[model samples]
Target: MPTLTLENDVRQFLGSITRRERRFAAAGTLITLLVLVPVVAVADPGLVPGTPAQSATEQAVDAARGDSCRDTLPADTPDYVVCRWLTPPQDAAAVAAFWGADGGANLEQAQPLPAQYVRCNRKTDLSTSTTCKGGTTFCRQLPSGWYQCTDETNGKVTYERYVNGKKQVQSTPPPSPSTTTSSTTWPTSSPTPSSPDTASTPLPTPTPPDETLPPDGNPPDAGTPTTDPTTPSASVPTVTAEPTASTTPTTPEPGNGAADGDFIATAKKARLRIWLESDLADDYLAGDTAFTAALQQLVTDAKRTDVTGVKFADNLAYTGFSTEQQVIRFLNRATQALRAALPGKRLAIGVVVPELGCGDSQPCITGLRKRAPLVTKQHVNRYLRAGDVDRVEIAGGLFGRTYRQYQVTDPKTGKPTSITPALATRAQWMSVKALEWDTLAQIGVREYGLAHTGDTSPWTMAQATAQIEARIGTAIGLGASTITLWGHKATADGQTYRLLNAGLADNPTWNGLTGQGLRGRLAVVIDPTSTERGAADIVHYAKGVSEIFILI
Candidate 1:
């Protein structure tokens, strides 16, 4: 052997090996074909093997012509035009994946091998080959045995099924065509399709009947049979409703103030007072016309109703008088007028007498004492006349005194022990009690009365009431059976009574006096100008008073 060059030696070796390998391969192929041919011939005649015998050129032509093995599928399948078999490896994997390692043996035992493995007999074109018992072919080419079925008409692969090279059996299906035809013809206007229409032609409109009757005439009744046919009976019955009566009372006419029986009973039981004063000066009196009118009306109303008694203060002429004579004259005239006007009713005169010591003096007790006699004599005579005055009240003293002597105090040795002298010894209350008592006695006033000083600066209603009660107690001690309380009224602290009767009924002191023959025996003289004055008078009188009277 000579030394071989690389290319030459390689060529020679390859040529020899090619010849040997070709002979071996041919032998193996012949053996395989023989084995397969017998199996195919003896196996189900419907089963065909190998790819359909078609030229590469012919396959190209058929594909371009849209000639597909898909024609073998039923027309109902969607996109049946694109159905085709899967490749060998994919089919084998599918079978192995589904049935495990023994899947190949089971597939072979099955009636036919898949169409993808069957070779076509080229002499028979699709026309004859397509009608094969177990497989379908087009133009001498076998179709793929596995087709991926899907809903897409665009031929998208969704899922696959291995269709062994076999044809389906034919059976008599239900009347599906007729059913589908009927269902598809249903109304398209609605969401769900409807069945086709089966109705016949509609009838024509009827003509109206002829009527020759009056405008208000009734129509013929359906139940009644026609005889003369001149008149028709009523179709509906008529109903009449009955009227109803109201139970509410009718309102009275406008002019009627109230129903006759609805009036409130007048308060026949009266225990209050009405005080009238004309002491307000001419100008002042003119301005108080309404007050005068109210006073007159109150008196008239009180007289109209039942009352205990009435007392009028007749001292108006004394108002605005600077001199003692002027005051005396005014008091006399007022007393006369009051007596004439209220003849039966008790009338009292209020006197304002000035203390002389108050004029340019220090500790004015001496000066007050000097002027006290003259002042007392004038007012006592003027207001204490018989038939002219019922009672005399000493109104003013200590007109401008701040000294406590005007107030009552206990006497020292050699001093006057009487309350009047003791009270007067004080420049402040000079001649207060003395003038009150002396005036009542000198004028022959049987019913003695006294009012607290009108100067309200130093005296309060409480103090005044206390003073009045003390004086009344003193008079009773002096054998005076009937005494009147003048000035200062009880105020509503909600503890006192509004009426004299109520007060007498409630007070313990007055209750005790009731057994002493003094029940409703003491008279009360109230100054109507004061609010607490009236109430205080009521409380005092109700504690055993014959009458409650207001002195104005």
Candidate 2:
């Protein structure tokens, strides 16, 4: 309006503002231009296009999710920088470029630098340690026996030298074979000289019946038999009886032509058994006369039906007794009652042996005890010495199912409390399992089951199936000849039993006993409540044992 001739020379005036101020103004103008983008384009000479603006949050997110390589020097490789990802060759090319390479190289082609030159600390935990700590300074192999971890934060590297999963430590040279005594051998059922050359003797061999003819069967008269006395009496007209068909055994088959009572015979032939808790048979504890009567009746009923190895188990921890003598008395009474009911049949006396339990409660004797495993071993050893225990039925309680959390009533307050009976974590469970099996195994008792009761976490059918499979597989792997399951009543959906069915169907050979009635090393215990379909599955797939014993 004042007739002022403005040159409109922005560059000439831009120098008037300080460099910092000019930059701010340029930023603001650029933002404003972007706000109204495509609507206006100022065509000014010597003006270069500006990059689009981004908010701090957006920039940060981009950076976090960006594919740019990072400074990873002093790493396992001198030429390689860490990339957000280096999977595809195309992506790895960018990673390679960060190392001043012409292009990305194959990730598979990358070789790690030597780790021997830079020793770090050994890991105290299962994880390989990377730094020296606890007076140690060497990255060693993990229990997994795969990679060696280093404590060094920088230049972390792993050297692989595969060996057995558990490290073999040589504390001292093993005593020379000549220097060793013969005491290491497991004893036979019959007593032998304590220091007999036990190392060379095999396990007791089963003796068949004498082959001589009965006195009732008049042998060829002495007058007619004049051959040499050493000639074996003309071989006594050797008889060759035809072998029984595979489907037929000394006992009747369960589903083919036998009654439910025949399940007893089936169980005996298969070495398959099912047992309910003593409470299930009768609310019995400490073996009172009533309890003894009830137990005897239960065995009598089972024997009447043909089941011979039937068992009724109770938690030894809940016996409300302290001294081992009292416990032994209880077991002895039960054994006497059973023997009175059935004279000579073997009974696998099942007992819920726990290393820890409620100090004084219905489920456990309310105080905390540390020597439960040892006590359990002692209890079994005592039972064996008592002469009625055929096999020690080790209930699954804590050792069998790791996924369970048991609830018990606090005797003093009458309140429910949750307890983790054994190791809860899967890793811990595996470790404990190995130890538990070894403990019982070392005692040389015929151990039946690392069996489970029905209590478990709510899991999908597939999950339950997999877990049962894993549990059974683990028990078998641990040298358990029989894998028993209890507590089917805990799962209402029948998923656990169904999953068990699927496992049996998947592998009949796992049973170790089939229709042939030839006893197998692997026996799977079933619940009395198993679905009809589940039972059929076991019967169909049964290899060594076609019969299943229900946990009553």
Candidate 3:
């Protein structure tokens, strides 16, 4: 018998395929089609008569699933998470509702499929799956008819959307930030100044500390969120307080009799310097109250001893102008303020990390401080020196804006290789985490993480856990003395604070107290008011504040 080549079979299938979708009776409460994927691995994809010339029906039928359908994530999956529709969904709502019902099992909720558009001229009707369109095809798409073909957009400032599984190419978006730089000028005109009023509201009681915190450092299941699972995204989230910029700092109200009282009570009085990035819902002042209150009241048998170093976060973000002088001024002012807050001796915790999301080519002082000079290793040293802030912190997404797609990256730099970006490319989400460390090291700043990033990172529990471990490894390699994990929105969600247990667990591999460590320096803190019964932080925000974060 003559040899039947793979190309010949693919050609024969494509040539005679009727493009009729098989119909089957619905058997389960949740519905989905049984999709058949074509074999696209043959070296010669040109076996068909023409590539892009295939009919829309053929294009839809020709779609290939480059990625496999997954429910449980692989162990190595890194920073981002990919949620797939197992099949080309017939009713997007049905799929959404089905997942929504099971929401908070992991993701915040089954989000209404979002509108992610691609600008490709070639077809992307079945974008959710890999298509036979080859490399020229727009590479990425969501089941919600969202797609991206930046290369083939033909220099037209238009974005493409797929509708009803049909290709509808061409719509205009404001020029991308990289093309025509968005204004970096300070916002005096659009100052919608408003302070959160919840600062004084006694924070919701946290889950009984014993039940939520595991002894070995695995985080709590990523099941909690600020919003009830059944609630719509629009309703106010289940929050006791969100500190607004104008709210005055108050003493930390007790949630429990100090989850770890004796150890903390005997500790010396910690004098710390705090630099307030007042714009970011004001999470830190509450942290300040929690820190002091813990110090004073949590002592064993009222044996409250004085402490030496206090936790003060120096997060300089949302400075809309790119200038050394501008950032320096903020540093000096913050230092002076903290110096006054604790008069004995100030322990400056200089945050040398991306507290805000960034886009490359943008100036550092530009609002959001995406990618620019001031935030770079070179200028960061000068700024740190100006503040005389010697302790370094490496964090992102703590206070300012929720980062966009271009702001986060998979940990291709570390081990176990367990991440894939769902919306953005690996390259697009650049992590300057190492750079943040380099800057701190250059200026002789105490380097590691403390109270930053979780609010800003667009990752799942595994990804966040992996990221913490990865950073600890990096910090250990750099001779870091301490590494801490603080989930800023801990009150709204429990996933980030779960890192506390993970941070405390010992890892012998890299001599790290945490995974990213060559040095064993790990610290975990949960905000006094934060609760484990809260909602998924990233997922809730991705749906609720849909405009700000481009859910990675």
Candidate 4:
């Protein structure tokens, strides 16, 4: 065994061993061949005293390939290139320990085997060997939420359980992925209460826009207004989104800022809030005339489309930080202008939390907690108390999954504090599962294939779809009323993989989840540019949750 030509050759040997071959090898020394190894043929039955001769077909079938299957296929096997269940050994230890205590199964003494010697069985499929026609066991789906796996060869039967769309031999339900429960009090604004029965209540649906909101809902204006509404004056410096000619309502109406008709009504009915960061201060920052024009255009567009909410936050779009007084002043002025533009509409102020990445040592969970609390107590709380805004929000970058299990280290001392997944989740900046909040639940989404995440493997369409579904579950499972799906159109070999705008509704996984009772309780984010696939998912998601947040 020339120490096996390659590492893959060793795995092939381990995967191909059969009980029958073991018996044959006992009668002789090692047989070596680069191609499929030939086995010993039985002698004539007439010459043997009590032996029965096997038919030609039986002999050929027995000699073809062993009926043994493994959790995965060996890399050197012929089908390894195309096998759907190809699972590469995770580490050197996994490869060395695969054969348990069989010390002789190492590379030096092992011979690589061909594909016909073994079959790859996926974790979901409980079916036995493909070649063992008569002796094979089959798993059948039953109505009782359990599977019946029957070994036809021995007439033996056993029950298996299906959990989270995967087949398992165990009977108990799987534990929650978070591995811990929180006793923290629920936020007052939580869409669903933390009670056990809270899942039963349907989330409140957004009222129809009375056929207004631009492209999707707004109706054309009847005519232009007789007078342009005056811009409201603010004690602090203010930059208002210039009112567009298209938005001036021809008729004067009353009720809920009806004079602001299409704009005010649309915002109220859709329950929308647009986040505007640093735009109010751009003129003061760099004297960028175009920047001011852009802000005006954004407001003008919102009014024309009947969008009502505009938020002001520092550090969202700008990299530099402004003084606390500057932020407060800007908020006051921006809110005044927004109220004047779209009277009776909601006004929100936001704070953009900065991301602290894994430095020389992992970030301590305690330190991470300090960050959120400091932001809330010092920055967000004071503004919320101002009583001028209808809503207060915090936005920031999410930590990638890779940091979840990193070794936590003290920021000042740079010493190891703890190296555990539980603590890491609590420490990560963007992981909602780890963070504890008092006033608001962060509504966000997740993505894969980005740098610095734990996941590094190339993604298949199936894997990507599964990931999106998992993210959806995690957000809703954590009591998120709204989820921001952060993803992009990724292409591999001419196929696209994405949660939004990637034609995912046609995917079987997406369609299967259609009526799983996810609607009303979960609001999903959608890209405004997703006119095709996203539109369909938005409609379905909105039908269930009552509203879809459009990412502009």
Candidate 5:
């Protein structure tokens, strides 16, 4: 009893315990490993009842080193790499369902346990892993529109309208790039506008011809009986284009000597251009002495007042002209009649320039291209080469001209070739939904591009400004004298025939022309007519422009 006591008591206690009981006691001591660590061979019926058993801890250590995992994985799998799902004894039966064979279960088998059996199924989404897959981008065309769809893996996706290779093969020429628009060198000595607006950048370095002012729009032989049309008039002051600072844009006051009731000649004489191209124009020029005299008399009356310069504002070369000679003759006749009425006065010509970077999405020069002819550039170049002209100026705002698909009657079929809403019979669309093939609704994105007529109404003020900048840039780049952006409606063309926000009273059109971006680069825009009046503000007289004749 002495100390058989503590030590001997414990020895007898261990010796008396059953084999299965002893294993349980050992497992309890290492409970941190896992709650129910199963010793595999313990339940073997063939083993002797009291034989020693391998410990659970030792099994776990071998598993941690991946020795147990190695046999089930591929032969090339690294020693450190474990096929975790296949290695666990408790999950063996369940994992087998995911992979038919033992060797088939590798590290890449993301799911081992079936969803229903695993109680604490904390499955991670492997797709979110940063190990990215290459080449997720894709593009294709569909009947609805062009689409570029990409990346659903980590949730980066986009389907957009894509312009395709087919754009290269378009029937019309590609739009001109903004830079290097023209071959003609811009003149450095540009005259400033009489308005408060100033120039941002200095004029280009090329010297413009000294101002000979030989009738800005006259044809080669357009001289009056008393004058030589080709000779440079030295007496005329050189219209200088010194740069200036930008100023606040303001509306032009109406009463600057322009008669209140006077309708614009362009609107009243829209058909005059077509006449100019025909034999009728030549006959009129030769025989209509009384009409020519009236034109001279009016000019003389204006000259007797305070008018400093006269500009023949029209779309002279707008669109296709049949022959260049007809234009030259018309210009010559107009120049001869007006030149004598005002001596030593500055004269100018105006025409339309094509649009660049127009529309909401796609740019189309079709409307503007339709305006340009070989004659437009030739006229300007002839004047520039002679060194007989002054600086260039621009006027007017651009509006959007929308074209719709209209229907034409089929001659043989007696049916509409393509049906628009207007053309659709009530029986087709309403009565039979499935049978309806064509309808009048616009198909897709419309071309809200350059404005040529009042057909399209007031563009946003910003669009108007952009249109002005576009025209100015083209006019200056080409060495042209004047650019008339849109046609006029002062005559009987009606309000609908209006051009460039015509019917609207308080137009933001031309407001941004005086902004620093334009004033700094191109001609300053202060003339109420959107022209760069290179003379002093006739009303204010405070800021004298370099040109001899101001708009007033």
Candidate 6:
């Protein structure tokens, strides 16, 4: 068998072996043993020593001939020359020593180098090899024992060697470029001169004089006298001028109890329509003689003050007499008296019929029920024609409760204990619907006043006043331009006294009623009287009037 000492010769001999011929295979085996066995022992002198040299040689040949053999070349070989026989050891120290010192250190540090036997462009290599490309390189064995390669473009290094007796490859990436400036510049010349200074010099302080004049026009010396004859003398004048008294006359303040003229003025400006009522009609007509003078004074005052109208309780005409005939006669007499008393002023007849039972007087109730209606309609109609009564107010319920009651039965006991009811009928001679009758009569007679009334007894004087005002306000709000209050006194004197006193105390002119929101003008009338009155007495008396009379 021929000896195969070189690695490449062994490889070639193995390549020529036949796959099917038994003799050629035997020959190839013998040749493989002779060629690779000695090289394996030389590379690894530490192989087991007990075995026969022949057997050991055969085992080494098997290792080299089999796939287990590694084709490691010795680092001592030049990088450009191919090794024909030598096999290298796998130890890291041996591999590191094979490369140059720097390369060996890098290999020992476990850096990665390019693969052995791979070609790279020379432009990319630092080895001065023509085969390397730009930006790339190849690994080359160094004189010591290790293999290494460097990236030409980035200056990064790679290495291949054995570390701790094991082969390894290592590579390092290049560092990034620096960003700091390389140098700094400085100014070498001076700046231009500044503009000429134009700031002004400060002014010099002035010295004060040693002596100053006193504020009172006298010399600084207190004892020195100002002797100029032209100057006014310091001595008191023979006739000292007194402060000129203010010539503007101040108005005398109004008396504390004086009526508010502003309220009256405002009322007049508003041009409000008014309703008037007197609370003392019944007492006056019962022959209360003192009331007669007072009543006349009230009407006279109303007229003097220019009241728009007056109302009288014609419905209570009989309160002056005990008999029905006397009542009728007194009613006719009172009507004539009021007409004469308030000649030019408007007059209205106010009537209130009893709605409840008469106190133990069935006859009176029956007579009243029948005659009341006739009297009211007759008087209203008669007055309308005569131009005495401008309107008729039909009010009721002086003798009884205005509201009705009904019997409420207990549901469980089936017994009635309480009485309750819907609205009660008003005890007027005519129903509320009958207002058209008087209204139509007023229209026919060319009178402007109309009629409306409220429950008489259940309401107090204040309530009645408020209700009247509200009614008037409503009428105004509803666009009615005019409204009138009508009624007669219980008697002439009583009517006059009540009207004058009430008007003076509570009417807009005297009591500031208009200021308190009682808007409108009022017309009033006094009952008939046989006495005569002087102009001043009438004027003064009329001016003292306050409230009107209303039938309750």
Q: lDDT per prediction?
A: 0.30, 0.32, 0.30, 0.32, 0.28, 0.31
TM-score of each model, paired residue for residue? 0.31, 0.34, 0.31, 0.35, 0.28, 0.27
Window of ten residues with lowest summed lDDT in model 3: 543-552
Q: Please give, for residues 52-89, the per-residue lDDT of candidate 1 as tens digits.
A: 23221011112223222222221222232233322122
* Model 6 alpha-carbon miss at residue 326, Å: 3.1
Model 2 spans with C-alpha error above 4 angstroms: 1-289, 318-323, 356-387, 397-478, 487-498, 501-519, 524-530, 533-547
Residue-level lDDT of model 6, residues 374-441, one tens digit each, is: 23333333434444456554332122111112222332355642211101111121122222344443
Instruction: Write candidate 5's Cα lDDT for 1-552 as tens digits.
Output: 677688888999999995435533533343323223333422322111232332210111123222232222112222332333224445433333333222122222332212111110123221222121232233343233323344433444443331321221122232343432322233454343232111232212222111111111111110111111123541211111211112111222323433211212221222111000001132233457644544543464345323434554323433223444445656566656556666765544443222221211112223323333322223333322332212222222222111112233332345543321111111111111111111211011001112223334344543344333333332232222222222222111111122324333224333433332332232111222432122222222111111222222
Worst 10-residue stretch by lDDT in candidate 6? 216-225
Over 4 Å off in model 4, which ranges? 1-292, 304-308, 311-318, 348-397, 408-479, 488-497, 504-516, 524-545
Backbone Cα, N, C clashes tallied per candidate? 28, 25, 36, 6, 15, 75
Write the residue-wise lDDT of candidate 4 on 1-552 in tens digits. 566667779778767996434423421232121111322322221111221232211111111232111211111222322222222222223332342222222321232212112111221111111232233345554444344566655756665653443335654433342663322222343242132112233322222211111211111111111111122321111111222224312111112222233323333354543332223444434445643554564455445444445443432222222344444565566667667776665654434332222322313333432333223222433444443665433332232232333454433355653322212212222232223332443333222211011112233333323332333332343334443322223222222224333343333323323434544443333434433443344444443343333433
Candidates ranked by TM-score = 4, 2, 1, 3, 5, 6
Error of 1 at 9 (Å): 99
Candidate 2 yields a Cα-based lDDT of: 0.32
Between candidates 2 and 5, the lDDT winner = 2
lDDT of 3 by residue, 1-552 (tens): 235687788778676753211101111122232322222221221111122222211111111322221211222222232334333323344443443232111111222222421222333323232331322222244333334445442433334443443344565443554556423223343332232212232222222221121111112222212111123432221111223333222323433453234223222112111111112112322356543443343222122224333433333332232355645665565456545654554244434333222322132124322333244433554565566554555442132212231232222222321111111111111233223444443222121122222333223333333233333323332234444444333432223433222333212211222232212233333332443332222222121111110000
Off by over 4 Å in 6: 1-266, 275-292, 314-320, 356-387, 396-552
Q: Candidate 1, which segments miss by more than 4 Å at Cα? A: 1-310, 314-319, 328-343, 352-377, 383-387, 394-403, 406-412, 415-470, 478-482, 486-521, 525-543
Residue 382, model 3, lDDT: 56
In terms of TM-score, the best-performing candidate is 4
